[model samples]
Target: MATVGAGRDAGQNLCGCCDDVVGGLPTGSDLDLLREGLYGCFGGAFARELVVLSPGSIVLAGNHTDHQGGHAVACAVGSYARGIFRANGEGRIRVGGRGLPAIQLDSADLDARDGGLDDLSAMVRGMVALFLQRGLAPGDALGFDAYLALDEPVGSGLLGESALELAFAQGLNNLWAGGTLSGEELALAALRVARERLGGSSAPMWQLPVALGGIQHLSFADSGGAVAERIDFDFAQEGYNVCLVEVGDGRVTEPASCSSILQEMQAVAGALGAERLGDVREVDFMMDLPVIRDQFGDRAALRAIHFWREDRMVEHRVRALKAKDMHAFLELTRASGASTAMYLQGTPRVARSQAIMLGLAVADENLRHEGAACIHGGSPERAILAFVPDSVYELFSQGMNAIYGEGACRAYEVVDEGASAWWL
Candidate 1:
């Protein structure tokens, strides 16, 4: 554990220039814990203090279509990653997290490749660089310090890296830009940062639910970027409990593991004379099925089949949510799962395991026809999402627990709010 405090105490390491304070505290319900961590690292003379937060989210629909310019439904989960911020006069921006050493950089000059580009430090540098490039920098004489933490984390938390990315970006906007940058702007900037560092994994709304908040229907159909519309519905009104059923700790991401699926889908799209399956006409695909099967092989054809059906299914599911028809939404979700199993998983890949399949079978015994279960976070699946009606939430939870063990199922509410900043 990283200790918080001042004056070179053993094991209570002070991150870059930290001194004159006493100790550190773990994250909890309030900003007090983050406040202490900030004071311990950068001193407490700063009057301007802000808290920025974004929740973890789940991809509700559009399984294999994120990169193909297709539409999807997503919602913010109950878990959140938050940051406490304050301005420091030294022109040195610093960021620290619970149980981790702080990373500091000069505000006047920023570098994307500096300091392990794959980690959170890169994100901090990217935020500073973005503000500076946009002519939105507060000033050369000012800098900021943020203490980041996860509150009530479930499994890996909903946002993962994007959660921290959104929090830090928004904090910078509020502290330095006079809160001028909108939530959409911050989300786009984070997407840009991720693209530069990691090659654009979840564009066009790189974790928009976290940055923008609420249950949303997102479309990547526009080439310019993502389009998100607020979805208004009371999930609890229907008495359905949305939960994530832990499958197992997913394996270390091999670059080729997840990409392989996208590549396979791409091959089929190419056979149809289009860049992505979304752009291909259904008639064109059906007419060219023989060519696709003969040229790209059966696996590619099958994945393309999954993509087309899923592309349409996502919009249908979104409509179900908009219509407030829980039965329709649940039915669509099950159909999506069946389609992925039959078409997308045509070839055996060790990294993409069947644990999720087994978990779904267990959920079926309890859900019967009233609830639904499917892979939670898309490929390299680690958790299964189960929608249980409130009347049977207990039975559903207990049944999942029996198979996956106790505490495997965690209830999550779709938070209506998105990312925002407040002074304390």
Candidate 2:
């Protein structure tokens, strides 16, 4: 709703951290200094305009928030942060963010780049610095304003915040300076900026799903980062039902503390030279169960082992679904819920909510009994996925509304479109 234009009359001060020149344009003398310093470093005179979208909620399969690492899924929402630019002929960079703050960067010292200004505004500047360091044309001085908007509902468990920021950065690169930057290149650069510049690593996983979508099974290899592969399945014709239940009053939180659990998992991984937990197979889990229990105390160890096994079961079920083995998929879904209840020690509220939903779906006379349901792990809130007959879509909707109260959950038709870019 708010609009800011780039000009001295706008009456905004440059961010001190970035050493941006604010208020009034420089005369011929100032332009001379700028030209002398920036000409060689920036290469040529160019300008660009760009827009970026935010990322949605992050779903973790295993506990651990602090780089201990776990599997997660995220999507890019419709909202965005945008940047518009115009070359000033002089070496001056002006940036404005709607309803936030404005920043100006003066490239007066090409040989001496300040590294102390670390903040959100500095992120864009840092990206420019990085580009220059790589011997790429850093573009010319320009006047620009950045705008940000988010479309997803607040607190939806989607990583909208991180996604939007990264999208904006990528959009800038693609729009302003035309070049071929692979998805992996953009992802890695965005990840470093989010971590080093933004003080967080949570943005990486979230950005991946937005950049690449569809039903993907993701795994991160230590030396190689994340590896994503699409799972091929025709849900529409296969007659499989998938429902996402919103449980726990929608107050989602990160997974439980995982310091000790990660240490134990690491030990197991070390023995097998497996870089990731997913690489540890069923036999590895059984063998390391006792060691994990000893390290994490009995209860935590038991829950961790249970989740590991159940997660593997889910992965296998995904494979079964791909193979169109409906019976095996249903059985595994039921097993997954049971394991969460007995071994993972999921909250009573979550376990009961999922159980009741699945039970009702199975008992319904009109609804097919060949469906499957299980709790969606990672979110603090209780949520479930039900695989049901497509013919009963309306019936299932009505039944869920009747039981859980109206608007308790949202329903979306199953989609298979992989991630793609769109105008905001």
Quickly count the clashes in candidate 2: 17
For model 2, residues 1-424, the per-residue Cα lDDT tens digits are 0111111122223222333222322223332333333333344335432223333433323223113233433223223332323344666555444343455676543333333212446566655555555554345643333444334332344233444445444544444444345555555666665555554443255555445434545555343356555556555567654555554443323333223444554555555566445565657766776766665566565654664665566567657756888788678767866775566554444543444345334434335565655555433244555566777766765676666667544443332321222221
lDDT: which candidate is best?
1
| Deviation from truth (RMSD, Å), model 2 | 12.3
Worst 10 residues of 1 by lDDT: 1-10
Top TM-score hit = 1
Over 4 Å off, model 1:
1-29, 99-101, 114-118, 152-158, 249-255, 346-353, 378-380
lDDT, candidate 2, residue 159? 33
Compared to the true structure, candidate 1 yields what TM-score?
Answer: 0.86
Q: Write the per-residue lDDT of candidate 1 for residues 1-424, one digit (tens) a residue.
A: 0111111112322232433322221123345667777788877756666766666677777766777778877777767676788777788878877755578888766766743324666677777888888988766655778887775442253334566677777777777777777667777888888777545565654467776667778888765568888888777888888888876545444235457777877777776777777788878888888988888888788888888788889888888998999889999999988887788762234555657677878888888668888775443356777788888899889988888789888888887666666655
Report, for all candidates in order, the number of backbone clashes. 5, 17
Reference-based lDDT, residue 423, model 2 = 21
Worst 10 residues of 2 by lDDT: 1-10
TM-score of each: 0.86, 0.60
